[model samples]
Every structure is written in C-alpha cells, then in structure tokens.
Target chain A: MPFSISLTVNGVSRNVELDDPRVTLLDLLRERLDLPGTKKGCDRGQCGACTVLVDGRRVNSCLALALSHDGAEITTIEGVAQGDELHPVQAAFIAHDAFQCGFCTPGQIMSAIGLINEGQAGDDPERIREAMSGNLCRCAAYVGIVDAVIEAQKRLADAGRREAA
Target chain B: MKTFDYVRPATIAEAVAASAAPGAAYLASGTNLLDLMKVGAARPDRLIDITHIAGLDHIDWLADGGVRIGALVRNADLAHDPAFVRAYPAVAEALLSGASAQLRNAATGGGNLLQRTRCAYFGDPASACNKREPGSGCDALGGENRLHAVLGWSPSCIAVHPSDFCVPLVALDAVAEIEGRAGRREIPLESLYCLPGDAPQRETVLEPGDLIVALRLADPTAFARHARYLKLRERTSYAFAVVSAAAALAMEEGRIRQARLALGGVAAKPWRARAAEDILAGARPGETIFRRAAEAALADARPSGDNAYKIELARRIIVRALTLAAAGTPQRLPALPASPFSSAPGARHAA
Candidate 1:
C-alpha cells in the first residue's frame, strides 16, 4: 500500500508517496527528496546525527515515521541558512571550529538553533552543555560546541534586539 | 524495522478499536517504540498512530486543585510549563532529568510510562529474555547485570523499569485515566506497573487495546514548597539513574506533617517508600530521622545480581533527597536539573 502524505520541507511544500511504512523521516529526506544534509548516524534514536526541526522542535528524524508527520512543516540542515548568508549557529560553529570530521555538525547546528529558539539556555555554558549533550561529537569538540552555542545564542539575541529596536 | 500497516485514528475510540487486533501497537512519539523495532525487540504488524487525535494534548487545571495531563503532552513542554512546574516541581525536575532535550521534545508523557527496560539482553534477539519472551530463560541473570533491579525481582526477570518521570508521579499518588474496549476507568499510577513476579512479559496491568488517556495528580500544592527529585547517574546529564529518589514533605511548624518518598532504578516499578513515609511523619528534620527513613525505605531491598551496591546507593539517595526536600525546592530548577551535583553547596556558584 502506497500512502500519500504532504509535508512542507525547508519552506517548500512536497507531496510524497511512501511505499513502506517503515520509511523514517531521515530516509525520506536523504533518499527520496535528495536532502542528504540530514545524516543518518545510528538509525536508532541513540544518536542525534539525524536531528531536524519538525514544527520548530528538534527531534530525531530517524525515529519519526514520515507518515506520522503528514502536513507538518519540517526544517532540516538544508534550510538553516539564506543564500550567501549563514545562520548564526552555522557561522559560530565555523568560527569556534566546533567540528573535526563534520559528521555530527548538522545535527549539532539544528539542535543549537532549537535550543536558542527555546530560550532556556541564555549564555550559560553549563546550560548550553547540558542542552547540547544530545548531539554527541566523537571528535571531542564539546569545548568548541559549547563555546559556539553560547556565541550563537548571544548573536541571535542581539539580532532580535536590533530588530525589535 | 519491520514493515507495518499504519492507521492514523481520528479519535480515541477509533484508535482503541483499531488496536484490538492481534500484533497491534499504539504509536505516539515513537522515541522508544521505533528504537525497539529497529533492534528487533518489538515487531508489531499494525501500528495505530494516535498522534493526530485531538483533545489529548492539553494540560488542564481542575477546579479542585488537581491537574490532568493529556497523554500526548510532550515531556519537554510539560517540564517547561511554568504553572505545572510551580505546582509539581518534583515532577518537572524528574521530567527534565530523564532524556536529552530532543528526546524530551519528541517523547510524550504516556509513552514515558510505557518505555521498556534498558536491559542489554532484552534488546538482543539472540539472548534469552523472559521479559521479551515469556518462556525463554533469563540470560540477564548471569550476563552483564550490574544495573539490574534490587528492590523487587524474581528468578524469572530482574530488569528495572527505566522511567524517571514515573518516580515522582508515583510518590505524588498520581492517577492514570485509561480507556479500553470495556470502558473508561481510572487507576493509581502506582498500580499501573506490575512486579515482574512470574510474568515478566506482562509488565503493566493494562490489557490489550487499553490506552492511557491522561494522568491526574491530585492537589500537589501541599508538597510543592518542599519537593526535590535527586538522581545519581554515571554522568552529569543524559544518563539513566543508578539510583534516584523523589522526596516531598508537608511540614508543620518545625515537625514533618507528612512525607512522600519513592525510588527509581531499584525495582520493576517506581518503588514507593510507604514505610519510610510513615517513619518520617512526626519526626523532626534531622540526619538521625532521615537515616531511619532511609533504612526503612530499603529494608526490603535485596540484590538480584551484582547490584548489592545499588541498595546502599538507594538508601543514601533517599536520605539526601529527604534532606534536600526539607531544605526546600530551589527558586528555580538547578542548571543540572535533578543531578546531585546540582544541589551541592557552591555548585551553582562555581558554574
């Protein structure tokens, strides 16, 4: 049975036909839609390499079945930046050198964005470390990741303040 | 993962009806369920996706000071709810302490209660697990069973229930509203989990096609002022508790009027320490009384495997949790949430 579902992926609406119910959002994005930026690390929920924004919240796309998210808006790594302008989190990751192999970079960036939007961790390094503990970096880049998140949060807050002013 | 027929039920009634078939399971967030399927621990032929069901995502404050939390309410949302946090600080703390931010964002309250144990043998199909397959021999009895249960265990199975959120709910005497093929009914949250006695596979009391709609906590304001959830884990965060405790006290003047205590990672269910609560009811707040309460809490705890250390750890945690609760809940939750280091003197200052 082919199930047809509609989703708004990275600001574009897409209608998809899933031939198997076992197809996860990670596979749907990387394989069918050709959005390969969302890396599949564990395929299980243990690793956050498959993290993405579903309805503005970070979730493990590998654990999310595509059919379950019909009509929902999703934001992946491919949607985080404007043309020729990097998102604050992405820019901060590069500035801090937060990645070595860059396999977990996409998930870390998306999780950082989600954490910043949640507004729970505000320049607190401990809080940022705790919040970003989900996206593990095997390269031992946690020091850089924490610094990057703190810097990105400050940047995003400053940008918001400027817009408000 | 096995290919399954997915049905998105529009209503709870339809969901319950669709789940009546054999080899059918309810799919909410799939944080735990999908992982189990990927490991071949769970193989359901039909999945009834109940995430689309409306009216099950609300957190309603009842007129009688109680609160009803819908089954579909995400763990992160519930933990971050200001009013809910104020009323049930221990619950919120416990919720925040369990999983990572992303997992908490996707995991639901009802699904948290139903999450299976993290026993390595149970996740491996090659190993014999009584909880996974009833008649199969228990491999965890002799395998790497350092983190197995200590309070309640039988020769059949020793896997502990791995839910941090449930420990505080059981301590608060939360009630579960369930709907089934027969009708709607309510049961105490403590009664929902069954001891692994002989039927390890039948972990919960829910029958087939039974769905948990909401969890109701009755008037938690009395203990809200002095409630604390303290978890001892291998790491500071994103780790399961080696032994965790939730302690809430309603004090009168300088004496303890009432106490609620429960332990996690020690038994098949959140082991409510009724005897410990009884011992602390009229006692003065001190280390001596707290020690007695801790001893009473672990009086029946016996190790199932190489986890004799957990019994002592559980006792010390109960004592520390009671002491922390008597001190009072923090003005805001600690940056580390329920970790013991969070409440260490000068810990926040050092941070």
Candidate 2:
C-alpha cells in the first residue's frame, strides 16, 4: 500500500504521497519533489553520487526508502547555497576546478560539506582524500577535489575565527 | 524492487509480532536488504521497519567491563565513537575498512553482521546459485570461482560470507543476543553462522521471525590492545576483502602469551584461526614463527584454480597482521602486488 510521509526537505516541509512504496529517496527527490541537485550514479549504494545530508549526516539517498525517513531533515546540494552566494565548499570546487563534466559536482560538494560538519575535513590532503573516498569522480579530478576540500576547510576555519573575534 | 507492506513498530514486542507474519522481514538501514530485493534475491511480502524500536539503538557499557552494542547502532557511529574506538580499535578499523562513508552512516550493526555474500552467482537470478534458489546447481563451481570459498565449503555451494565485522568479533569472543518466538537467547558469534553444508539456503541459525537484539563483547583482554585488522582488497578503500585477517597478541616477557586470529574472504563463515593461535601461544613472536602459525591456519585450505592465490596471499597477510599486532601499531602493510590469476569480472563469466 502506498503511504504519505512528511519530511523536511532542504528547509521546507514536504508531505509526499508515494504511489509505490519501493520509491527510493533518490527517486523521490529527483522525480517526485523536482529536486535534481542530488545525482544518481549507480542506483546501488556502491557509488556515492546520490549522497545527501539527513539530520546532519551524509547518507546515500539511493538505498534509503522514502517512508523510512518520515520526519528526517534532509539537506541536498540544492540547499547548500544561501540566497545568491554559493557555500564555501561549492565556491572552493569552482576556484580549484575540482570537477570536469560536472555530473558528480553536487554529490561531491554535499559530501565535502558533510565531511566538514563531521569534523573530518582537516587541512591534510591525504586525510581529505580518504574521507571523500566515497564520492567517486569518474573524470579523475581527485587532485583538484582534494585541493578544493583542503582550501575550503582553511577558509571556513578562518571565517569561524573571525566571527568569534 | 517489490512493493511490500511497510510497518514501523515503535516497540520491540510490536516489531517481533509484526515480523512473525508470513513473508515478513525486518528493515534496519536497508543497505543490504534493499539491494538484495532489487536483485530478486529477497522477496518479502511485508517489511517490519525496526529502526524506530525503542532502546534498540544504544551503545551500552556492561557492568562486567564488556560492551553491549545495540543492533541498530550505525557503522559510522560505532566506528567514530571515542570510547568504542579506544576500547576495540580493531573492531572500529574493520568497520571503517569495508564500505564507503555514506554506506557506513546508513548501515547498522546487525545488518552488517547478517549481510549476504558478494558472489556474482548469488546476486544474479539467472545464475544457478543454491543460496538464492536451492536445488539449483552451483554455477560458481565451474565459472568465476575466484570469490568462492577456500575453506568449509560443500559441493552444493562455495560462497563465502563477506562480513568484515564478523572477523574481529570472532577474535574478540563476541556473542549475539537474539529474540525469537521462543524467547531471548545468547549464542556465541562463532556458532551463529553455519557453514554452507548441503543446505546453502540456511545461511544463519536464525529461524523465521528471529531478530538479533544486540551483540555483547567480552572484556577486552590485554591482547586486544595490540590488535590489527588487515584487509587486502582490489583497491585501498570501498572494496570487499579478497583476504582479510584480524590478529591480536598479548606479550609476556617478550614471548607470545596469548593470541587471537580470524580470517575472512576464504571461508564459508569467519574462520577462527585456532591452530594459528595455538602455534603462537608459547612460541616466540618473529617472522619464522608467525609464518609457521599462518601456515598452520591455512593447512586445510582447498582453493579453486582461479583463487589458489588466496592461500599464499592469506598466509602472508596473517604473518604481516600478526607482526603489526605484536608491535601495537595500527599501520597496515601495503596491498600485495596484482595476482597472476585471471582477474576477469565474475559477472561476465556465463555458466
């Protein structure tokens, strides 16, 4: 039987009615709610292309059932930018040319934001590489991706310090 | 994916009662189950979402200095927990080494423990996998047997259990607390997994409607402090193990006092290297002694033509893991060189 569940998508309240219970969060976001920022690479959980933040933690949206997350506060790549300005991680990706073809940019940006929130995006390139290992860039732009994450971490840290002072 | 009746029960009793219905299965995280469903491996008519069951998501410390990890504890949370990482670093390392961060954040403890094998035949419905459809001839017997079992396999099926957590849990002497129609019972983690005898369909000893409540670990012995988990995969991260070893050692007067060892990717279940541990008990800790122990562990290995490299690869991994364990170092040895065996995609080979 199909069920409708309320979810906090990005920042707005959403009550999506599912005609099929098997509709994954990836399909619900892209097809149902018209949120296409979260890209689906491999429908399976192997690829991290469908990564999104659920309750401040990054999870592959492809594997999650829509009903399983009844009231989860979901934040996709579309929600990252504030007004007209891009998030620091998004800006860093552009400044460093972290992506080519740009298909995986949304998931990569979301994963980087999650890595920083999870307190794992240190200034170390190797550590950033390991943390971001989930989000695969088929274009082999890992060098720039790692550099962008490191640079973004520094910028965020500096901005936090300034805010504190 | 098959559309099934989904019920989110708020309590364990309600969850258990709901799961007792015909063709019902519990869903937690759904990392493995949902994938299997998509592949036509699992066709449940009803799903009891146990993620909301109260008190089933905690990491509690027992009064006996052991740890009781609830079934719903996500892999990332357990891996990142300061206390869990400090107490059982090998367990945490094993969890972190298997899947990606996104998967780890969604996968739960019990689900990880009960995950099915990654054998190509098992996942493909067209393939003759006895695990998926009993009485179907084992297609992997003659085709793409590289990922098949090297130990404790029957002619009926040769698939190995692909759980990274079970390797270290077997070394740590963990027990799973199960709830079923009868009542709650504690079973040693070793006995919980049954070898693929003639009945390849019966993976675990879990009966219908049986649910794993939590896993209880014994107090970390001195050996646990100097432990290491070495997983040799095709790549460094986000890959299943071709051969993995979990080794723990307790040194006394510079001699081996106690040792615990377990091997994965070469067995029907997590094969505890009891013979290796016996060899290391009174022997000195060195290259030659560790090599002998590793040899003793693989004495009964029966490898197929495509996976014969696993025997030698696993032997070297055991010795290297033991060496690191003895030194109390967490640094993993570099992955072995590419194998001479056929590295063709297992799914491409037709029966």
Using TM-score as the measure, the top candidate is 1
Report the lDDT of model 1 for residue B296: 92
RMSD score of candidate 1 (Å): 1.8
Per-residue lDDT of candidate 1, residues B13-128 (tens digit): 99999997889999999999999999899999999999999999999999999999999999999999999999999999999999899999999999999999999899999999
Name the TM-score of chain A in model 1.
0.98
In model 2, what lDDT does residue A128 have? Answer: 75
The residue ranges of model 1 lying beyond 4 angstroms of the native Cα positions read B344-351
Query: What docking grade applies to model 1?
Result: high
In candidate 2 chain B, what residue range of length 10 has the lowest lDDT sum? B342-351
Residue pairs in candidate 2 whose N, alpha carbon or C atoms collide under 3 angstroms? none
True contacts kept of each: 0.81, 0.71
At residue A129, give the lDDT of candidate 1.
88
Candidate 2's residue-wise lDDT over A1-165, tens digit each? 569899999899999888788989999999999999899898888768999999999999999988899989999999989999999999999999999999988999998988888875477665677678889999989999988988888899899999999
| lDDT for each residue of candidate 1 in A22-132, tens digit (9 for 90 to 100) | 989999999999999999998876668999999999999999989999999999999989997999999999999999999999999999999999999899898888998
Candidate 2 contains a number of clashing pairs equal to 0
